[model samples]
Each structure stands twice: as C-alpha cells, then as structure tokens.
Target: MKKYYWTFIFLYAAFSTNAQVKYADSLLTAGYTQVAAVEYERVLFETQDPEVRNEAILKKAFCYKLLGQYNEAYQNLLRANLFDENDSINDRLRYESVLTAFMASKYNDSYNQYVQFKYYSKDTALVDQAKVIAVLALNEQQKWGLASELVSELNESYSLKLDTAELFAVSKRPKIRNLKKQQLATTFFPGYVLVREGQVTSGLLSFTLKSGIVFSTFYHIIDKLYFTALLSGGMYNVFYAGSTEHAIESIKVNNQKKITRFNEKVSNSLFKALETSNFLLF
Candidate 1:
C-alpha cells in the first residue's frame, strides 16, 4: 500500500508539471511574453528533470530577449546550461550573446564575443554575419582603422549594401594638425580661430560680426550715463572670455568630432545593408 501511494504521488507531480507548461505555452501564443516568462521561470524552478528545466529556461530567455531585456536574457541563456564551448548549441548561444551585447550598446563586449564566435564556430555563414557585426562595433567606437581592415577582409562577392568607396574614403584619417597649437591659438583669439585654420574669410567675418555687435551695443551708451558704459563694457568682457574658452575647447575637439561623424555615417550605411541581407540577429 505504501509503494502504490508513492507511485500515485509521482504521477500527480508529472501531470501538474505538464499542466503548468501547457498554460505557459498558451500565454506565449497569446503574445503575453512577460507573463509567459514568469510561468516558465516557475517551471524551471519546479521541474526536477534536466531537459525540461533547460527547455523552460531557454524559453524564458527568448521571452526576455524579445522584450529587449538583454542582461536578463543572457543570464537565463546561461542558466539553460544546454551547451558547452565547442558544441553547436554553444555556437548559437555565443551568437545570441554577441547580439544581445550589441543591442545593449556594449560594443566592445559584442566585438570580443564576435571574435571568439568567429574563431570557434568556423561556420562560414555565421562567421560572415559576425564579421558584419564586428565591423559595425568598431565603427561605433570610432576605430576607423580596425573597421577599414575588417571591411577589406570581407569577400567582394558579398555585398554589405554600403558604398564600399565611400566607406574607404571616410575611414581614412584626416590630415593631422598640431592640436596644442590650435587650442592655444583659439584661446588667445576666439573669433579668429577659423581664420587661422585656413578659414580666414569666415573667421574674419565672425570676428567682424561680434565686434560690430559689441560696439553697436555701446554706441548708444556713449552719450548716456557713465554707469551704462561701464555695465556694457563689463558684459562685453564676460562674453569675450566665455567665447574664447568655448573656441579653445571646440578647436581641440574638432578632429575627434570629424572622425565621429564619419563613423556615424558608415555605421548607418552598414545597418541598412544588414537589413537587406537579413543579417540582423534580432
């Protein structure tokens, strides 16, 4: 009688687990991913069977991933424990990990993971997809040189849908100027920095415009109270100082901004290309 009771208890547990899983599937079918994820988590915790637990965790991870909760998704993927480093399942998981990091704006992590995925997977199609993502990661970090090198390695037969010529053009380093000298020049002469940087016409134009504004403001005050003149001059001096500091910072950072714009343009193009190729991992 005791042995029969134990058998009945085992049957009840199995049936209960199956019912819970069925409910979770219904939630998923209804597009209630968050609710489904909770249900799956419950299953993952309660199920003693390794295979069922792994499948539950994997489903939960997918639900989180679809919701753009990458950290949670990656954690659950790891919890699935369905793959080893060299297994095909491991390769797919690595791809998902890299993509999740990319979506989270963790470009360096994505790039490093893609490198490993590429090296270990050795699946030509997956490796090619990794290359595209890796290049995009480098572009986001403004590592033009590395991005350009990766682009070169890509097979010409495959189109990334980017203007290859434009990519190369934008990746080339701009002519380096003496940054210190430019900063000093702008600090000393705020309105003339553009002129000194070979934009003499625009620089002088700006300087003239600012001087005109300053002088014009005081022109009417010449005949007014002495206090008014004093106030005007004080305000002019403050504006000049602030403008000088801003000009110095802008000059110093101009080269960096230039590179950033190029990278941004190329990265946008790369994304468009990926869309057409259906390479985005989602």
Candidate 2:
C-alpha cells in the first residue's frame, strides 16, 4: 500500500498540467532565474490553467527585481494586474516593483508606481515594505517631509520587522544610483561649421562668403555628431554649446550678388538634409 501511494504521488506531481510552478521552481534551483521568469509568463497567458499562475508571476517579477531590471518587473506586474485587478498579489507585486525601482535609484519611476499601488495593498508585510522603501526613495529625490512621515508610520507599525533603530540603518544605506551623462550640443549657427567631440573640429576657419557674393554649398558631416551649416552669415551668431554662443565670427560680403544668391539656395538644401538625419546629437 505504501509503495503504491508513493508511486501515485510521484506520477501525479510529474504529470500535472500546471507546469509553471514546477518549471519556475526547477529553473530557480538550477540558477536560471530569468528562464524561470519566462516560464511563469507563459503560464500567465493560459487563463484556464489556474494551478499557480499568480505564484509563477510573482516569481517572475521577483527574478526581474533581483536582477536590477526594475522596468521589466514593473511592466510585468502591470500586465498581471490587467488580468485580475483585484488580486492583492498584483498589488503586492506593484509594491515590490516600487522597492526595486527605489533600490535602483529610479526615483521618478518608483514614486509613480508607489502612488498608483499604495492604496490597493492592505497586507501589513507589503505595506511596511513599501513605506520603508518609498521613504528612502523619496529621500533620494529630496522629499524630506514625506519621508519623515513614512518613517514615523513604519516606527509605529506593530508588524514591522525592525524597530526604529534598524529603520535608521536601512534608510541610511546607499543604493545604486543612476549616472547622468553629459550631452554635447550641436549647433551650426546659420552656415557651415565643423563640430567635434571634446574640442571643435578642424575646417571651420577660412569659410568665407564674398560680400554681395551669395554662394551655397553642402558641407558634409565629416563624422558623427558633427554639423555642416549652410548659413548666410548676415547678423546672427548662434550659440548652442554649454554656456557661450558668442558672436565669434565676423561676416562680410564681397561684391558678387548673383553668385551669393545661388550659394544661399544650395546651402538651404543641405541644411534640410542635415535636419532630416538622426545623426545630429542633442
């Protein structure tokens, strides 16, 4: 009797149609967390099969969250909620995504998610988790008063894992922050100019338009992020870089009216082409 029952149990567990629970667990054990997440997502698509879809999805969101892919987790949680908005689990998942986003220092994203889901989750564990995480996230975003209130709430919550002392330590810990990249500006002013990284490129000088001699030429972008301005240097000295767009170049027209007008038309065409290109860096 015992042998028969053991065999029966083994077979039942193996032949189960709900593969998500087993697959996700197996993948996690095998260190394929991302693969587990994918398996769970597939289970979510099969509506009739309700074995462990929620569990699987939670696992998936967790995997993404652990891997520091907060955006991916946030999207998955959002999709899962669309299927069953009332699922407290989805609310919890939203809160989890918010925490991950906070840890990742994506303050704007985290704050937005927190605001959307804070009212829905009633679980003490999840609520405390969110409050604690959100306070720090808000602090990172320079919201001091709100953080203090959140911290105060956490301190008074009986279900909180830590007391006020631990809260201080957790809040003080450093999170991985987003690095801001410095973007170089591209400005052609009203005519042909050379742009380069770190320093201005060569060939901007000696570009002369004869007085009353209008001429147009398409200056090729020698490289990426470079600008070729077909400009009538009449009055304006366009400034676009960090601080100074000074009236650097002095413009003069040499006697040659008809030729200068033709130049203007050609330069205009080139400028249009450059504008259409995506290579122009902001």
Q: What TM-score does candidate 1 get on C-alpha atoms?
A: 0.57
Ten-residue stretch with the least lDDT total in model 2 = 246-255
User: Residue 236, candidate 1: how far off, in angstroms?
Assistant: 8.6
Give the alpha carbon lDDT tens digit for every residue of 18-63 in model 1: 6777687668657797998999999977877765665566566667
How close is each model in CA RMSD to the real structure?
A: 10.8, 20.0
Model 1 lDDT on a 0 to 1 scale: 0.66
- Residues 1-282 of candidate 2 have per-residue lDDT tens digits of 234323433443354456566766667557686787777777777654433555565567666765667677666665554245445546656766676676666877787777766776666565655655576566556554565566556445432333334333444433322111111112223222232221232223312322121232222222321233234332113223211222122111111232344334433433343345432211
Best of the candidates, TM-score? 1
